[model samples]
Target: MLVNQIDTRQGTNSTPEFSHGNTLPYTGIPFGMNYFIPQTTFDNTSWSFSPMSHQFAGIKITHQPSPWIGDFSDFIVSAITGDIDLKADVTNQMGSYRPDAATFNPHYLSIYDQRYETKTQVAPTTYGALLKYTFDEINPKIIIHIPKNGSFILNENKNEIKLLIKNYDSHFNDDFKSYASLKFSNKFISTLITHQDNPKYDSMILSFNNIDELLIRLATSFISYDQAHFALKRLTNLNFESAKKTAQETWQYYLDLISVSDYNTIKMSTFYHCLYRTFLFPQRCFELDSNNNPIHYDLYNDKVKKGYLYMNNGFWDTSKTVYPLFAILIPKEYHQMLLGFYNSYLESGYLPKWLAPDERGMMPGTLIDAVIADAAIKGILTKSEIRNFLKAMLKSANQESHDTRLGRMGMKDFNNYGYLPSDKYSESVNQTLDYAYSDFCISQVAKLLYEDKIAQKYSHSALNYQNLFDPKTGLMRPKDSSGNFKSDFNAIRWGTDYTEGSSWQNSFSVYHDINGLKKLYQNPNFIQTLLKLSNQKPAFKVGGYGFQIHEMTEMVAIDFGQIAISNQPSFHLPYLFEYTDHPEYTELLIKQLVNQFDDTMNGFPGDEDNGSMSAWFIFSCLGFYPVCPGSDEYVFGIPIFNKATIHLPNGKQFNIKTNRNCPQNQFVQKRMLNDQPLKSRSLKYVQIINGGNLDTELCLLPYSKENIELPFSLSN
Candidate 1:
């Protein structure tokens, strides 16, 4: 079974200073409202859990997408046996557990506490989870670790506890709270609520006298206590085994969407592991009422709103791969997500950039425009929806918001000067480049709705990237408001004008018009420049950040030259080679890049960023990538698998077959779609979803001649 093959710990071996994937071993349904992970530490920080740690703190229900973002509405559930101080710190109560012996599955989690002499397991549902505890001795007790500003009521008569937690990192209302209900199968002999001076370690303990085993059903809601109880009531009829089966079935349904036939067990495992990460983000933020209507807590207005809402994703990362993959495999969910994002626009004045629970707005540009435009071009959204989203896009592009998190930064300067002035804002070069690509996305949406004037206007704005092109350095440099490039420009310096990258990495971010980017260079020609970027020494200066960031460390660790696959800004760099005469370089680079990933705790090269890097691997393994999300084409690479099949949402199958498909055969000699010669080295969105066969012949040697039928470019 695919679910069995997945180790939830794949990418959990990480710390705040260095990351392997910077991911947690999340055990829950795909895109579940809450995920339950085995917490190994009691640190009041984002690095709360690590697979390498032997300490068994508890099972924590977390809404933490990235460690940098922190967690919201989170709490821990643990089982204990011997005498332990209730008011003591969480680390004091933690027991030793063998990390190697623990089960870390998507649908379930299991760990044996050696000190407590108890075994704990959890099976998660959409809104709730079923927990089982088996004790080796009497006096089995359960501990609930509540965060600060949390209160709970124990109803001994009903064998249940009601909890209210008020916690968030940022971008939440004062009234933002999570209500949860915990229903126990066994009656507790005694219950005690302990308060600590340090609010982070507050606890409640429930002791069962004679019972050797117990079952706990827990449910939570952001709406109200009634809704939380309702969610718990839905789980009342199911046992641990039944709930586990349901969770497994739910995950299997999504995991089975793409089937790969490869004899290499390790490679196949890595593919599935990466695939598992792809569906874990943009989690459901809305819940169904008694009438089965979707409703959500609106952080913008602090009111209960009616609609399907999703959260915990940053469009800056996901716009590159996740949504585009959804366009091909899960259009229904993608369409619903579009409505949800549109509803966010209706609630908040602008569209979301990064939504942990609400818009934390952590990245550059309102890149959701790319996601919406990709869906619009693929016919995944209605005309009315497209028009509504286009208005929101234009609002963000043209207007500045009072809250910098809501819309594009330096919007007034960007609109007036054609680029974000370096003097006005930090990371101005990235802001300018991202805004230009977003402008192109807006143009695509406008063209879909047949608004030619709007399309043309945004298309013109899209070329604003060219404003920062410094011909002497052959890189995109920052420009000041005085219409001059910034002096003392250094291409190898990190994060003064760029976003998490140096000019060497962020320069070629012209996703909508790579050929146009190539036109800016003369002596080096874009091809030679790309060669230098790939072969240059992997050295960097901590320019703006002053200290070395993890991204810089990760890039040097992999030694992939300026192409920092460790971060999203460099995701499309390798694929850019496809537009030049040397397409074989792209195939070779993709093959080498994918080797950095595996099916272990340290599975990824760096922070996966809510499945952006995972989707990158998924696409690269399939021999293609959505380099430009707003564009409807996927640039080709060499397939890693011998055979693979995509079960399209429209009840069709898209098959991919690679001949001489091995690690050694990394270059494509010939390509065919449905048995016809495919010379363009690209595939259209329609062609993929409509279902056909893509056959490629790969070899060790490069193709002698250039295949010039390149992908979509504004200049073309």
Candidate 2:
């Protein structure tokens, strides 16, 4: 029921091309390897499914993580009637469709082509898809088009087609082969295949005299065509409707895990939509063999291996909120994912920072350290597994990777100089802050494993952020190798010593040691500091980046001074108010943010990169947030819903009830945890999993006079 309410297109519509929510209306299972979308353009661009586009190119099988990262092993499937456009480009061959009359959901997508009077629907399995079509006229046809550098063959049997695609978009290798097996329902009168002069764009069109309906079952694999067929054998017997129902049921299971009761329909829809986005990443990259043994293609080794693996995620964004959500809602799957990540480490010799098919050392810091530490703290991995995890983590922190493309960059410099210098890496400020948090994560895991010597070493290393902080300016400016802070610093500048952000956004990212970070501020007036960030004019000086990046534009659009909630670094900015004298200021800011998002196409403040932004909204709407991953704590915020129930993994229910809850009633007057008076503005991980009722009374005025405990801090 909840799946039916989700549009699946909430964040696909962007203000610029890829500024806010560079997301597609993806249709697949929770962790499906392949996501299905109606490709509206034939340009083969990363953004193929714009919500406003009326053209129907085909149903694309994509493994695109983000537009900035590009796509791999992608191809298109389309249904047409009466005509063959062998030479037509995407626009010339495209059929107009009404966006309003289309069906878009997590499990299914349907579009009616106004030009041909054809309705196309598609449903997905973990590694395959079932596409059905209905035509209003006679002489129907099906087209399977592969993008640049592709070739395919139509088996003379007329029912089965074997396809192969060569894509070189990955960073791990110059090129890789992807295979697919497609089975059609009707006997084709004739099959005509075409190859453009450039040899990049190739297609096969199957013609039928007349068919009211048709079904196309497709299975894809990066390994071989036989494996692709092996993946689809189990689903070949299921009808179109049955496949649709099965996919819908699979999605409903996850969507029903958390239930919300509110009179406001838009807010409820927004909550469920955000919740839906959180489970769509880290897709399953491994498939089971004949004996149900897991096997995957090892890009690092350039061979197939027997092991479960996962890909298509960046830890920089996900470490903040995604993994913490999984620890609470789906710990079993989380455990499996950890094992998968461990496999990546075993193959590549280091944990991945960003993976799409393979390691793409993007973003700052090897943030998987936070993921591993959080899983260990939650007891998700076994004793032996944790030990292995610790070994891989230690190696990453200490050793220099064989390839500069893997592991933490400038590791030797950081170890020797105590901080990565601006001359060494472009994002030195972000590197210092990110690695500091990662050091704290390593310390947490070491402490859990009784490795006190290692724990103390990394714990001390976590304070490296202090070396970059300038108390006078209250910013973490980049430093040179000689231990001197770099001059000519502008706080509003974007991407000089920071990653897609300025010093202000990356300054307070010592989530593991907030108190240590706060002490670096001379004024210690965090409330005013946050206010300064929120009230400043939306001005920026493109520092290292000569022109304005999309992040700068998004931050200016949000107009929250310099606080760029448009990106991940500023996610915890609003909650920082709790550290100051006035905790209620956070409540107002949280309310403003939650109200900004809705259940429409252009719903997010910025790119919901791999569900980080969505997870932020989900946690805030539930009245808590995992501000720091390995800390095992969630900072309290204002709840948007009146009542909500969480189906905890331990079979107990965690309920949150708010009295007189509304947009106006943003402040909490009093709170009770399990009928006991609560004074803290935070909740522990144990309290949430143990499952109990948390009730709060709301008021129009701030509860400023009350003495409330601050969120979990290292000093406290």
Q: How does each model score on TM-score? A: 0.99, 0.97
Each candidate's lDDT (Cα)?
0.89, 0.85
RMSD of each: 1.1, 1.6
lDDT of 2 by residue, 216-277 (tens): 88888888888988987877788888888998999998888899989888888999999999
Backbone atom clashes (below 3 Å) for every candidate: 0, 1
TM-score of model number 2: 0.97
**Clashes by residue pair, model 2:** 21-607
The numbered model that scores best in TM-score is 1
Model 1 agreement with the true structure over 1-716: per-residue lDDT tens digits? 37977898888888877889999889998889999998887777898887778998888999999999999899999899977777676678888899889889999899999999999999999998999999997678898887776888878485899998887645547678889999999888888887655436568889888688899999999999999999999998999999999999989999999999887888889888888899999899999999999999888888898999998999999999999999998899999888888878888888999988888989898899999999999999888988888899988777778889898878778889999899989999999999999999999999988999999999999999999997777899998889999999788999979999899989999999998888899877788889999999889999999998989899999999999999999999999889988888999999999889999988989999999999999999999999899888999988999999999988999999999987888889898899998878789999999999999998888876464598989999
User: What residue pairs clash in candidate 1, if any at all?
Assistant: none
